[model samples]
Target: MVLRIFGLSFAVTVVSIIIAALYGGPQAVLLVVILSILEISLSFDNAVINATVLRRMSEFWQKIFLTVGIVIAVFGMRLVFPLVIVWLASGLGPVLALDLALNPPADDAAYFPDGSPSYETLLTDAHPQIAAFGGMFLLMLFLGFILEEREITWLSWLEKPLARAGKLDQLAVIVAGGLLLLTASYIAPEDTVSTVMVAGVLGMITYIAVNGLGELFNTPEEDENGEVVEGSSGGPTELAKATGKAGFFLFLYLEVLDASFSFDGVIGAFAITSDPIIIALGLGFVGAMFVRSITVFLVRKGTLSDYVYLEHGAHWAIGALAVILLVSIGYHVNENVTGLVGVALIGAAFISSILRNRKAAAAGGSSDNDVDEPKPVTIS
Candidate 1:
């Protein structure tokens, strides 16, 4: 199963390494490997969260995810997205932006000898807005999940209280908006305050719009007999796997989520090397393939069903990432710190899940197959 799932990723890793080596020799190969590991480590939680959504998608959409979705993730986010950001941030034309990315300044230089800002500088300059947009979107996701009531809780003490507080309408929006405002007013640079506010609000709105539309158009799954399949729990039925228009929106949500997750990684890649080709090879080819494979593995193996707290862990990690991104607008947060915090949260959750499983086994309860049933909370 492992080989079947990850075979393509391994093959791509070899191909990416070879490309990197041919493009810039052994040093490039090492950089690409490091960047790939970096992306995977940082995005492991992303894979978990993705599985939660991807499992609901039909096989056709799943293939779309592996094919078209990969192109978007690799080129659109890794290569083109950064270039677009540089273009807008620096007032450079698309052609010039592409040129700047390809012909970056030398190491230890922030600007070209001709006095123009390097592609890295332009991208770094754009970080505040990027952070604002991506941070708020992810913050909404985390807040929405954490605020929802669930049959199972990973951190009950905290989650229970939050769930109770969730009874208040639009609390997540309120909190996220307040944070964005606070960050804009005090945390972000004065000149970029307006930009941050606009970007952050847009992020929040995007999340609400996509998620709202998805639920609004959601229809229950039907069995082979055309009977409505009831949810796992008795009371309210679980949201059916989205299809048609709903599926397109959900897929759109996934892409935006991927872009948000990739923001920091794309920006942080400059800290490793300024070679766009190497970054594309590492992040787009090798790292992204593995992430997709991991998502597939989790979905096919029913890992989320088996490890009930994993979704919670991934959300918490996303919350941490959101905060880090917002904070990074004013301060420099190490990518290593971002990666470690996620790993720590997910690791702790995994351990707790195992313990819970063991306890349930001792009680002769069938917990191994239990899945999280987070009660649907209205996102106004």
Candidate 2:
């Protein structure tokens, strides 16, 4: 079953490794392998959150996620997005950016020292804006999750209070907006403050617009009494049936979510290697495939339902990542630190979920063990 689901991903992994080997031999192969690992480490939490959303979607939309969505994630965000950033940052056309990437000059050979400020350098220079946009979008996502009233709680001490506080309407937006302004004032450079602030605002607005659009078009269903419910009932099968225009918006939301996760991964890749092609080939291919595979596994196996608190943990990890992204704008956080924090939090949550399930099972067994099943009455 696992092979059936992840066959394409395994194929892509082989192809990516072969391409890496062909391009730069053994050294390049090793680097691609390392980058792929790094991308996966940074994005495991992403898969969990994606599963949480994907399970709510219909099978058709889920297929879209694995098919059309992967294309956008691999090529659109991983490959072209950085080039677009460089083009915009350098005030040069896309062609010039592509040229510079293709034929990088020798060290100290061009006008600027060390090969005319490599693609990595250009991207690093634009970090403030990237941080602003990605950080804000992620922040909104984290806030929305934490501020929602949920029955289950992973970290009850923290989450319970937040859920209580969520009663204030739009509190998440207000808090997120205030934090953005605070970051702009204190953390952002004086010259780039306005740019960062604008980008952050835009990020928040984008989240709101996407979320609102999805809700606006959702087809309400009538219950037995003919009362209209906001969304379809039951699992993915029901969702798949009713999803139409709203499903498209949901697709848009997932793309944006994936982009927010990729933002950090893309920037972090430069720390390992500055070659844009290598980054795309390694992280874009392997990272995306593995994450998608994990998402499918969770949905097919009903992992979320079996381990209820897993979703809670994933959301908490997201909240942590969102804050880390925002803090990274001011401080130089090690990529390892960023990745490990998420892993640790999610791991702890998984353990908690296992313990809870065991406890529940034990309690249920204790109660029912003494109760005998009714003796079968045989008709002679």
Candidate 3:
């Protein structure tokens, strides 16, 4: 499997290097590799999350995820999301920024000899803003989770209705993504840190809101053969199909969510190193392998049921990332604190799950295998 993964990655690296060098020549190869590594580390959790979703998708969609999804990820999110985020942070978009940074005034043409913007000018224009964006994103993620959690308590009266409204996991993610975009555009300061913070926090929000609400609304059902379907509300036949679709969409949602989580790690890596070619190739190839393997593991090995609350741990990490990003936006976001708080919360949850498992064992309580896991799904 490792060799296979490497071989696949080599193919992808060659592709990325070719793409990166389209403008900058062979020198850009270094940049692609470096970026690739950064993305892989940041997106490990994303792979686990993707597996949960990939398991539910049709084989056709699964293929789409591996191929088309990679395009969306490497090109759309990695390449384009940064520019959009930076534009939002600075209030001067690519065109305007290029004009100002290169010309020192919007009035001049500011055209490069090659008819392109200078590398130094663009970097200087966006670095501080990206950092600030990253910082803000982390902080907001932390606060939003805490805040939304509180809303759960306050909405005791309308709990059922609101939950129903929030029932669509896809909608929840869309909302979170939209919110992040809005915040980055309107609220975050114009600096590099802020840009990164916004992306990270948005990723955190989408993960938390989608997963949290979906978990809350989860119910169980019974099949025609009288076998119980885990995590269902005992709904009728029609809803069972809906559940299947929801399960499938939930999987797609996870992939998008993972992509978002990967943004900060990708960008932060730039500060530690240079070489865009290395950056792209390394991050794209490694991240691809990680997510694909995870998808396979969950589908084949049934690991999701075995390790209950592992996903919860990831969501908590996203929440912490949000706060870290936010704090870093205006001030400094401490890695230790960000990591510690997330670890504590998720650790406590995991321990609680283990303890629950132990107690269940003592009482012969049902395992998630008997609960969350159902009969093997057929893609047909």
Candidate 4:
């Protein structure tokens, strides 16, 4: 599995480089490779998060993530997202940005610098929005923790009255969406309101659609052929039917989650070099590769259940990413610090988890076996 994953990673890199070369020559390939690494580094937290949830997905859904998701992430999000941002922020249309990206209308070779987009200007122009976006996301995370800590049961009053109301965890999704929208309007400045709102609505829509579909399509199990009939207590063991609603929602959430993870790196990529094309080349492919790699690792390693805090770490990362995106609305976001903070927290958690498990093992007096701990990531 490791070898297969590596082979695929290598193939992806080679193919991306070849595409870059064919389209824009050697410089583009070099730019892409660098961007790819930067993206992967910026999004280490995302890999961990993907590992946690991808494990829950059906094999078919997992395959979609590996094949289809990467395409949207690299080309659509990394390469095009920036331009789209600029287009929305300023009156510069995407076509104009694309044109500028292809052939920068700069006179001096020093400024033109291999015909890359003037990412320096963009960096200065977009940092506050970046900072605001990230800041808001973090606030949401912290707020969520506080809210979760509260004795707010899942519609406790309503559920108690109506026993068959079913569990209502959708509040978290709705609250997340509402918070994002509120942040977009008030927390984020005038400029990035659109971007943050877009992201929030996108997330909320995914959460709602998936869950609603799951509920709508869920059956009484026994009617389906060879199915594990679920009667809330005693049921045979059969893979529950997927109405595709849950998968769709998971896909949507995963995409948003991926976006949240990639935001810091996307913004930070400009700091590495003031070349948008280079930024795209480096971060896009690398981010895509990491996503693919994590998916494979989770499937093969079977380590998701072993590391409980990893998912927690990922959610924290997502929260952090959301804050980072929000803060980008109005402040300067440092890539190194952002990456470091997440890495440190997750590392601490991993250490604590290991220590806790060790203590438990000692108390139980199990055989002298060392638990294989998964590595910690820098981001969620």
Candidate 5:
């Protein structure tokens, strides 16, 4: 299963290296390798979250995620997204933005003469709004999950209290709003404060709107003998069947989720090399392929249900990432530091999961085989 899942990823890696070598020789090849590794490390949590969501989606959507989703990730987010940022920041058209990307100025002064921000500079100027939007979106995701009551928790001592507090109406939104105000005031520049705040609010609104619509339009499940079983009315249910509207929204959700995850990596890639094509080749293609491979592996192995608290850990990591992104609006955080924090949090959760499994075995609750084995999936 591992080999089969990763076969395409490996091929992509080779292609990335060849592209780099042809584009910029041995040095660029090395850059591509490093950037790919960096993206994978920074995005491990993304893979886990993707798996969590993908497993619930219909098989058709899963295939769409693999095929169509990759196009959006590699081309839309990595390529066009940056160009769009440049266009917005510099008031340049798409062709002009593409030109600036292909032909960057000799120095920062040249940018002023042309009245156009270089691609990298435009991306840098747009960082605050990008960070605010992605951060708030990620915060909402984390808060929504953490605030929900769950049977299994990695950090029971704290999680139990948070779960109790979950009963508060609109608690996540309120906290997210408060954080947005505080974050905007503290980190955003005086001129860009309103932009930051507005972006943050839009991020929150996007999350609420997408989720609300998904829940409202979610279809009922069909049981054996082709009978329609009514689904729960109070909350959103996993999509059992992918209709046109439902599937589109799920696709949108995943794409937005991918964009949020890519924001940091895209920015961080500039720190390594300013050549947009190389960055796209390394992080966009190679790194994204591996992420998809990891997601598929996790889903096929039933890793989430087996480990139990792994999802909790991923959400916590996301919260930490959200905070870091918002703080980065004012501060220069090393990407290595951000990546390590996620690794540490997820690592601790994995350990906790192991300990829980041992305890369950000792209590004769379930054997390792019972826990780790993948269950049959119903894909309609």
Candidate 6:
């Protein structure tokens, strides 16, 4: 099962390394390997979150995620996203932006040796707005998830209070908006405050629009009396698997979620190397494929169902990342610190899940072992 799931990722890793060797010899090969590891480690939580969404999708859309979605993720995000940022941030036309990326100026300290900003400089210079947008979007995601009432709780001490707060309509938006304004006013640079505000508001709007549309189109499961039936354990229920427009919006949400997660990784790749080709090879070809494969593995193996707290862990990691991104606008946060924070949260969750499973087994709760079969979902 492992080989079947990850075979393509492994194969791509080999080919990408070979190409990197040819492009810049052993040094490029090493950089690609490091960048791939960096992306995977940084995005481990992303894979878990993705699995939660992917499991709701039909097989057709699942294939689309692997095939067409991969094309978008690899080329559109890894390569073109940087170019767009440079174009918009620098007011350079698309042609010049592409040219700058292809032929980055020589580095000297911060700026180019010729005193012009390098491609990396332009990209990093745009970090405040990027962080604002992606950070707000992810913050909304985390907030919305934790605020909702659920049958199962991972960190009951914290989640119980949040769930009570969820009883208030739009509490998630209220908190997220307050944070955005606070960060923009005090945390972001004065000159970039307006830009940060606009980006952050747009991020909040995008999440609401997509998620709202999805829920609007989704038809929840109904009992014989036509009453809606909620999930027993309360995460993504079978309603999430709706086809047509609901599915499309859910798919759109997944893509945006991925972009938000990848924002930091794409920008951080410059610290390793400025070669766009190498970055794409490592992040797009190698890192992204493995994330997709891991998502598939989790969905097919029912890993999320088996380890109930894993989803909670991933969302908490996302919350931490959101805070880090917002904090990074005003202060430099080490990439290692960002990565380790996520790892630590997820590791703790995993251990907690094991203990729960053992306790259930010791109590001879055989009923707890069975995963609920997804019910048929209606789409309006």
Tell me the whole-model lDDT of each prediction, alpha carbons only. 0.84, 0.78, 0.50, 0.57, 0.82, 0.83
Residue lDDT tens for model 2, 1-380: 78977888889989989999989899888888898898889888889887776765656777787799999999998899999998876666898787777677666245344345666688887877778888888788888878766656778889889989999999989999999999889888888899889989988998888877776776656768978754344321123233777777778888988998897888898888878778988889988888888887877777776676777777778878877877777778899988998888888888987887788787875222121211211111
Question: Between the candidate structures 1 and 2, which one is better when assessed by lDDT?
Answer: 1
Residues 4-91 of candidate 1 have per-residue lDDT tens digits of: 8899899999988888878899999999999999999889999988877776665676677778999999999998888888888777
Q: Of the pair 2 and 5, which is ahead by TM-score?
A: 5
Count of clashing pairs, candidate 3:
77
Model 5 alpha-carbon drift over 4 Å, by segment: 107-116, 220-244, 366-380
Please give the lDDT score for candidate 4.
0.57
How big is the positional error of residue 200 in model 3, measured in Å on the Cα after superposition? 12
Error of 5 at 70 (Å): 1.1
Estimated TM-score per prediction? Answer: 0.91, 0.90, 0.55, 0.68, 0.92, 0.92
lDDT assessment of candidate 5: 0.82
lDDT, model 1, position 18: 83
lDDT of model 5 at position 247: 61
What TM-score does prediction 2 earn? 0.90
**TM-score comparison, 3 vs 4, better candidate:** 4
- What CA RMSD would candidate 6 show? 3.7
Model 1 residue runs over 4 Å out of place are 105-116, 222-239, 366-380
Q: What C-alpha lDDT, on a 0 to 100 scale, does residue 334 get in candidate 2?
A: 93
